[model samples]
Target: MSRRWLLCLALLPCAAQDVIQDWIREIEQSGGGQVLIARAGYDAEANEIRLAPGTTRPELFAEYLHQLAFVRELMAAQALTVSRQTPEEGPLHLILINTARIAGRRDVEEAVIGHELGHAWLRTLGYPAVAAGNSVANCLAIHATDAVQHILIRKELRRRGIDAETPWIATLNDALDQWKVRPLPAALTPCERIQTASQWVDVRLGLDEARWPRITGYEAQLKTRYPDIEQAVSGLAAYLAGQDVAEKEVNRRALLEAVRRLRALAPPTTPLKTNQ
Candidate 1:
């Protein structure tokens, strides 16, 4: 029994290693061996992104690199390249976004960059181009981060009886952190779950109305079947854009119902593990 237990313990690390190796192998296949991500010349700002040398775990850096590589893979899949000094439109400049002010805040870094990346992907797919500050663009930004950070910030502000319209950087910072770690409950339906999660942002920023059309427009692009829930929440975004709170509420309730239907159709849970 002791030897068997020891063997199990030994196998655990091996399993983890195998998983990591499998992921790397997938990355290699996805890139077709043409991907190259290196920490090239650092700017003054990039130098300020201070993770302690040697003390910081290498896994975090590897994960960050993996995301960058994934972006490259995306570009390659589309048959494009980042044009540096040429005015050709294809792939995005593979930039490692590093700013001194952005240090210690991984979520915001992830959200902001992720939003920009979404724009790049969209351009690659060919949509009517809209500027970043337009109603459509803001919705795109929120969606890129999965509406998680905006929803959280709005909730935190409202809980303190603070006006949601106010521009507060500290609040935004905390909200980003919250979004980074917040887990969706397995019990909620995906659309309901996304809407419930994005409620505060929708209410506060008036995203329901202002952003609905754009959000709805994205549904045709989605490969998933939660169309009703997405469309309902998107109406909320549109209403918020129009400052139609009453309509937003109605849509929110409808989205909740749709979520309930989804949950009933499929109970959310992790799959059982099997010893291979």
Candidate 2:
């Protein structure tokens, strides 16, 4: 994809204005981003906090709220905000799906947000200032960012009310937690290794990728798997064309749109071509 494609951001629906301003203040005053993430809010026993119905893991309830609030802070930081225009220089922008279309589970929804936040946060740490489509840098940075996200989210859930032994979260945390201990799969291909690392979050949680859930786990998978227009005329056409993209309409439509933009930016020859 051309630099323009990387610069573009999608139009996200406006969250409630009051929510936006309040969270921005919290994030700004919290001193450090990590501090904001680490601080606990009202106790579960307090009337102010309530868990979502049909579940008790805290992810859908207070945990989700806490994460969302933090996400708002991240958004306000000027890094995580999603806009139609891209900056000449700043963090590599986050690619977020329409939140309303994605299923309404709080944890899953915010995790999607968190995944992008991971990228935004990474930018502060000196992750390459390339566009999101830079597969190699994006891949390595995403894995490391995801690992850090796991720690933050898991810790926040515990502070809200969940115990380490809780099945859903324990299993979820374990999935992300233990992967760090294992050897990262060797990258045999440009996007393959990144795709594998991106899958860690979803595979362990058993979230169905076929349905196009907005979970962050699908980030690299979708990017690598998402079709790019350069696939048709560029020298790397075969490489782009060969990707197994998602079939779900909501997800596929996005892939197609992004591809169209990237296609416009395609050079007379693609960089992905073999022996280029």
Candidate 3:
């Protein structure tokens, strides 16, 4: 049988590159086959990395020399977990880093990579896979699953001493500030409402609203803005909160329940806008 390799891509300074190379070595040493680091755009539809458009031949070759690097040792740590927990899943891979997502901030970039690595770790432990289906169903399932997974990922990140909540807090704060300047939309489609609710639930569950009082305020604002999906969103948050992430079966059950709850709020015949 042919061995499947894990791929990672990024553009970073020399210092960061050295750090990530060490991570690659650790993954390889832990019985994950040779680690290949490259740079490219992520294809969400296909769920893999590929050469983006307008790439020059020289750029492609030079990418190998750079060997994409993330901000800190977080990647190495998560790679070790995946390598040890389920070597049969194939080599540890970091997937692709869409720089735009992180806005070129190394700290946020580290958190994003760490978050993705957490998802990869969950997969190794037999967390339920999103069922294959049409784009609408698939998109809903992915969001629902993500809602549940974020809880678990936050836990893992906290254990590693990473402040997973700060980045999200900043994002929500920005959104809130913008809303204060300009009123939120008077109405949104069922699909849009549900998607926003799901994201709000992620932020709610991930942070302590008591500490960050703004989170509580944000919930109130969201409820006012999206009254239709508020019930479903709150119920989903409660259900996920009750789950015990220590067990794989509990995680699986939570994901399925989340999907069912979110699906109930989805428009019956309309296609969802899945892009975030």
What TM-score does each of the candidates earn? 0.24, 0.29, 0.67
Task: Name the runs in model 1 displaced over 4 angstroms.
Answer: 1-89, 94-98, 130-276
Global fold similarity of model 3 (TM-score): 0.67
Candidate 2 versus the native: TM-score?
A: 0.29
Q: Which candidate has the top score in TM-score? A: 3
Encode model 2's per-residue lDDT on 1-276: one tens digit a residue: 422222121122233123323433343344313211111123336734332232222332233345543333332221232211225422223233333223333344334444344433333333222233233433333332332233334443344343322333334444455545763343334333333333343233333445334335434433344334113223222222343322233223323333333334322122221100
Whose lDDT is greatest here? 3
Off by over 4 Å in 3: 1-94, 189-191, 267-276
Pull out the clashing pairs in model 2: none
lDDT per residue as tens, model 3, 133-152: 34346446556767887788
For residue 157, model 1's alpha carbon misses the true position, in angstroms, by 21
Quantify all predictions' global Cα lDDT against the true fold.
0.33, 0.32, 0.56
| Clashes (N, CA, C under 3 Å) per candidate | 13, 0, 0
Candidate 2: segments with Cα more than 4 A from true spot:
1-24, 30-95, 98-101, 104-107, 114-133, 160-189, 198-276
lDDT-superior candidate, 1 or 2: 1
Q: What order do you get sorting by TM-score, best first?
A: 3, 2, 1
TM-score of 1: 0.24
Per-residue CA lDDT of model 1 for 1-276, tens digit only, reads 332233224212433333323332343354322111112122456632232233223343334333443333222121112212223422323323333334434333333333333323322323212111222222232232323223333443344333433323343444445544873233543333443424433443534335343333233323143444455455444443443222434334433333333333333342211111
